[model samples]
Target: MSNRNIQLAVLDMAGTTVADGGLVLRAFDIAATAAGIETEGPERDRARRYVLDTMGQSKIAVFRALLGDEDRAQQGNLAFEAAYDALIDEVGVTPIPGAAQAIDALRTAGVKVTLTTGFSRGTQDRLLNALGWNDIADLTLAPSQAGRGRPYPDMVLTALLRLRIDAVDQVAVLGDTTSDIGSGLAAGARIVAGTLTGAHDKDQLRAAGATHVLPSVGEFAELILASRI
Candidate 1:
């Protein structure tokens, strides 16, 4: 025990846990294709950049930013989920090395674990079942269930409330995107950790207010046991 006094770890899906193999971007492309949106021009490139920039944000938010309307954004979100589901069906869920083990180790330490993601409930459930992780986490939340997603602190706040953990400082929020860092910081978590295995680079994570940066989510247990993260 490193005496970190942490009680819970709020994790992100996709790049943070599941091995992000450009599948998300490809899914976005598929959705765009389904929606018959711009694909081969400066406009498409800019949208893709925005998607990367806003990783860990609500899919609806990303689509709204990219598509610029509620109806169109909702359509894009549905299409994205459909395409991502298809991808998962074809290839299956691939966990990041040590992600499941890390979660189990944290649970063994008596730390409650919750997963918070921008992915909707259906998609989240699909991934969880594929990983056989449906029973691993103490809580599973999606933006559609929570008020908002990452970079807003809503997900973290919801977890704290639902878990009945009064002290924000007793929690660790870990992910691989700036939105994750921002949300953790906003929620006043003691450890806002960013892993390099995902979307944002170290500099971007730092710029977004990550208190600690690790090589991957796998190192979280070690870092925490060392009183680092």
Candidate 2:
């Protein structure tokens, strides 16, 4: 039996379990251009850097920070979703190698998994449908489904409540971004692991409060199972 007593697992979507192949930047370029940011200038360059820096945050929140106008942010978010969906049709998306097996392992061990994303619910559903993952998770949450997105702890806490998990400490969180680490830490999860299959690096994940750094989500089931010994 696992001694960690983790009854719930909260995982990030894009860049963590889902490999989107840098489509985020491509979509962002399209959205930013539509939002009046020039294609090749310093302004667009700075915005792109910001996008990379805040990879796991809510898309609308990121756009709000970048554009600074609620209206423009809304427009940019819509444009981003449209472009990303189009790209998904063009290129498709895939799961990180072994991520499905890892998730299945965790669930078979009695851990209820909830997939969370910073994207809007519309985009999240589209991604899930594309990957045929609509039924994979015990629950899936977007910022709209919860109160807020990562770096805020709302989604994790919401999962705790929705899943009827008894305590926050019985939860395990995993992601590839600092924002994911921050959300897990803020929610007081017992195991806040950062995987290398996504945005941030080891140092950044540790700095953001990851309890453990993993090579990939493929190792997550082992980490949880090994806690028994």
lDDT (10s digit) by residue, model 1, range 1-229: 2345888799999889888788789899988876667779987788889999999999888998887888888899999999989998897779889998999988887788999888889999999998899998999999977798878988888888899885888889999999999999999999999999889899999999888999887888766656634
lDDT of 2 by residue, 19-91 (tens): 9689999999999999989999899989999998888889999999999999999999999999999999999
Model 2 residue 106 distance off true place after TM-score fit, in angstroms? 0.9
Q: Best candidate per lDDT, number?
A: 2
- Which pairs clash in model 2? none
**RMSD in Å for candidate 2, one decimal?**
1.8
Candidate 1, residue 227: CA error in Å?
Answer: 3.1
All candidates: TM-score: 0.95, 0.96
Consecutive 10-residue window with the lowest summed lDDT within model 1: 220-229
